[model samples]
Target: MSLFLGTHQNRLDVKGRVSVPASFRSALRKEQTKENHSLIFRPSHKMPCIEVWPLSIFSELTNSLDSLNLFSEEHDDIATTLYAEAWPIDPDREGRILLPDILKEHANLTDSVTFMGLGTIFQIWEPIAAIERCKAARHKVQQKTLAVPPKATKKGVEL
Candidate 1:
């Protein structure tokens, strides 16, 4: 799995294009399974930002969704929500992708864009909004101590 870490900020050009951060691009390269790697962008239902999913992770999501009964309301709703406005984007040689107008408007992206790394997935946000979200997230987690259990190695040792 790709491990994306750290936050990056970049300018949004007048042409509606923004460069994906170098670190994020490096992570994406590690996750690539084809000559041309693509990213899936979807408006975040839970936040004012655009959620980016590496194709591999998105495939896993689809596979899990397939477990649901076909055409059932639950399945249909989830599929529609995920696919209806999803945009598959290929970053150019310059590591820039054109930000879709709808996505920009959804996130209220203006002069600058902020990239927030979250392991297998990441998010694009408007700078100010991103800062606000970080504050809120930190505040929420301040009252709790959360940690992921270590994974076991091949020799049955925890890591």
Candidate 2:
């Protein structure tokens, strides 16, 4: 129900807590019961970032991953990395979640952080890392767009 999408940069407090952006918090509330809204955090395999998911979404993702053959090398690697890094957490009364210290260190998170909403899940990034990543991504998109020009349409077409 919480179809979140977009990026928001925020700061973490001294206690290792980050306030869920207003839009993301509202979206998460829509997906879970009022009394039991939960969140999980884990290190991202692709980057120096953390992945955050609602309890419901996390369960759904884990269930899908469960169908994989755990004996296979690929599955074993994924399982070990994901499970070893995962941390289940819930927000405090003030609507902030405590990020694990190890995870924070993994991402090199210091005073500033970036929260990027990606539909079913979200990512936490160190501000500098996030900026560089975004720049690189934008450049790739630009190159692709330039490589393939938009098709011309008839004047009467509704599109």
Candidate 3:
């Protein structure tokens, strides 16, 4: 129903290509109004992973950036960094995308890579790296006493 909802593992071929997951491919197809279904692949600013976003999402980001005061230091910094790291990607006929050297180096990806779903965007992670991150996150959550809000009914009463 939505884009990038699950984890998938795929291998990079000798030519540095890896297949996009089938569900992700189908999602991309729906967004297709032109000949090519393209994406922006870049290094994750927060992690050692590749961040993948549709062109439309990047367009929306640019639109939001346009609304920002051009002279603002934060805007200038983000605009510079985002545009510098992103790459426009097109998958081949076989639904494989060629990973660039910089991105691969950043993620430490060799033969195997894991695609992790994040609703609007997805991440390419080394499988072991992904596993370690997941474990660490779970452990961190377990150490915290997070409060859960009570469920609400239509009448706004807690249930």
Candidate 4:
């Protein structure tokens, strides 16, 4: 997998379209198998940012839904949560996507937007908020509050 790794800042155009960083576009190009190149955008449940997922990654994410009981409330709720606010977006020829109004409002995005790479997924955040988030993440690391998990064995048990 081509991991998204870096921070990029771009201006949102008057039409609310923002150009995706070239590296991210390339990563998506490598991952997409379908003719229509697209991404999934949604308001992150836990954060004040827009979650950006390449189509393939989004599919893999939703696959977890298969584990839930069919037609059960738990399954319905999860499915609704995942699909309700999610929007599929195709970048224009210039590699720009029109930000949905809801997502823009959720992230408090104004003129400038920051694109943050988080390996499997990326996030669109307001520039200042992105900087603060980065600072907080660094602090957590310094405080030893976050660490890599143990590697999993073939049996799927952590070692």
Model 4 misplaced stretches (Cα beyond 4 Å)? 150-159
Reference-based lDDT, each prediction: 0.89, 0.83, 0.87, 0.91
Q: 1-159, model 4: which lDDT tens digit per residue?
A: 788889999999999999999999998888877765678999998899999988877888899889989889999988887899999999998999999999999999999999999998999999999999999999989898777766756336556
Query: For residues 50-158, what per-residue lDDT tens digits would candidate 3 score against the true structure?
Result: 9998888777777878877899998999888788989999888989999999999999999999999887789999999999988887788788954555674633655
Task: List TM-scores for all candidates, in order.
Answer: 0.90, 0.81, 0.84, 0.90
- Candidate 2 segments exceeding 4 Å error: 34-36, 146-159
Least accurate stretch of 10 residues (summed lDDT) in model 4? 149-158
Candidate with the larger TM-score of 1 and 2: 1
lDDT of 2: 0.83
Clashes of each: 0, 0, 0, 0
Name the top lDDT candidate: 4
Range of the 10 consecutive residues with the lowest summed lDDT in candidate 2: 146-155
Q: Write one digit per residue (lDDT tens) for candidate 2, span 84-131.
A: 879988877677888889999989999888998888899999988988
- Residues 1-159, candidate 1: write the lDDT tens digits: 668788899999989999999999988888787754889999998899999998878887888897899979999999998999899999999999998999999999998999999988999999999999998888877867545656747336657
Error of 1 at 42 (Å): 0.5
